[model samples]
Target: MLATIQKQQNNYVVKFTRPLSHSVDAVWAVLTENGKLQQWMSNLEMIDLQKNGKMHFNMNDGTDAFEEITITDYVYREVLEFDWGKDSVRFELTTTSDGSLLVLQETISELTNHTPKDLAGWHICLELLCDLLNGIVHDEFPMEQWRKWFVEYELLVEDVKND
Candidate 1:
């Protein structure tokens, strides 16, 4: 589903809420464990799993380069927030009666032409994460799906901006 976007004070907040038929622990592992994390988000790796710890964004450009991301907040299986450029990304998990609910929020300092691109990328990553949790895997990114989402997000962003 498309995430809800809103202008929050000086910044814009994009929030995606996903209800998954998996336990909180299972979903948490995929978000935190390097092995499982690679299945969905290959570039991000949790080098230190604590508040103020670090995660690395691998360049993946054949140059073993990486950008260090600081863990702004961490609370075991419940919350994880980290720096994302001038903004920040946060993941929160909660147990449901049947499974779990995952909330991903990205706080954008400013919306630019590239904002929709980042939102679409994140939308695809969440879809991939859901597939992995459901025992399905993809060897490569579904670029076709991303292209479709990018257009949708572009429109969505414009609507939010007008509001």
Candidate 2:
């Protein structure tokens, strides 16, 4: 089972356990390389993989939406860190007895209305990544799941307002 979510410092930590039949290098390539990223993500561009390297991605939709991120730290096949505007995202990979344990820590500058949507999007993207890694063709996100989550998120917001 996946571990329960937790909040540490200014970031939310999500940890998952999976029996990845691939090597750590292979998994790292999928996460860092541009071609593999496009297979799972949408518009994608990456610079040299080094400290302060630049990474950019656009939403799949033709809305011209984009994110500019900077690599803060890089430890081959182990950990990667980046900054997206005011948010800092850290990706850590540990070799387990069976496979790899992946942990993502995302620190936001401030909690705002967009927090839930951002979290939901990341959750879906991570799932998509897993599917791609498992030899499944994941060219796009599952909109039905996104829609369901969005509706539930709206209801949560409404409930919060009433309280």
Candidate 3:
């Protein structure tokens, strides 16, 4: 499903809810493990796994450069939130009777043209995570899925503009 995008005073909040047939621990690993993490979000590398920790974003373009972002409000298996430029991205997981519910929320300090793009990227990342958890591994980024979500998210953001 498309994420719920809404305006909140000075910030624009984007939320994606995913119901997965896996334990919270299993889903948390996908969000935290380096191997599974690279599969979904190759750009981020977790340097520490605690409150006031660090997550580095690699340029991966050349030159071997990276930007460090601080992690805060972290809980071992329940929450993980980190700085994203002037904003923040948070992941929250709750165990269900049969599996788990994963909520991804991005707090955008300002609504810009790039907001939709970031939303689409996060949607695709979660999809990749879903596929990986189900043993449907892809050796590369899921551009096809990303392109599909981008179009849908663009429409979502446009609706926000109209409303």
**lDDT score, candidate 1, position 78:** 98
lDDT score for residue 147 of model 1: 98
User: What are the root-mean-square deviations of the candidates from the true structure over C-alphas?
Assistant: 0.6, 3.8, 1.1
Q: Looking at model 2, which ten-residue stretch has the lowest summed lDDT?
A: 1-10
Candidate that beats the other on lDDT, 2 or 3, i.e. the better one: 3
Q: In angstroms, how far off is 8's CA in candidate 1? A: 1.3
- Give the alpha carbon lDDT tens digit for every residue of 57-130 in model 2: 67756787777778999988888888856777777887777667677677666545775576566666667777
- The global Cα lDDT (0 to 1) of model 2 is 0.68
Cα deviation in Å at residue 62, candidate 3? 3.0
Model 2 pairs whose backbones collide? none
Query: Which 10 residues in a row give candidate 3 its minimum summed lDDT?
Result: 108-117
| Model 3 C-alpha lDDT per residue in residues 71-105, reported as the tens digit of each score | 97799899999999999999999999989999999
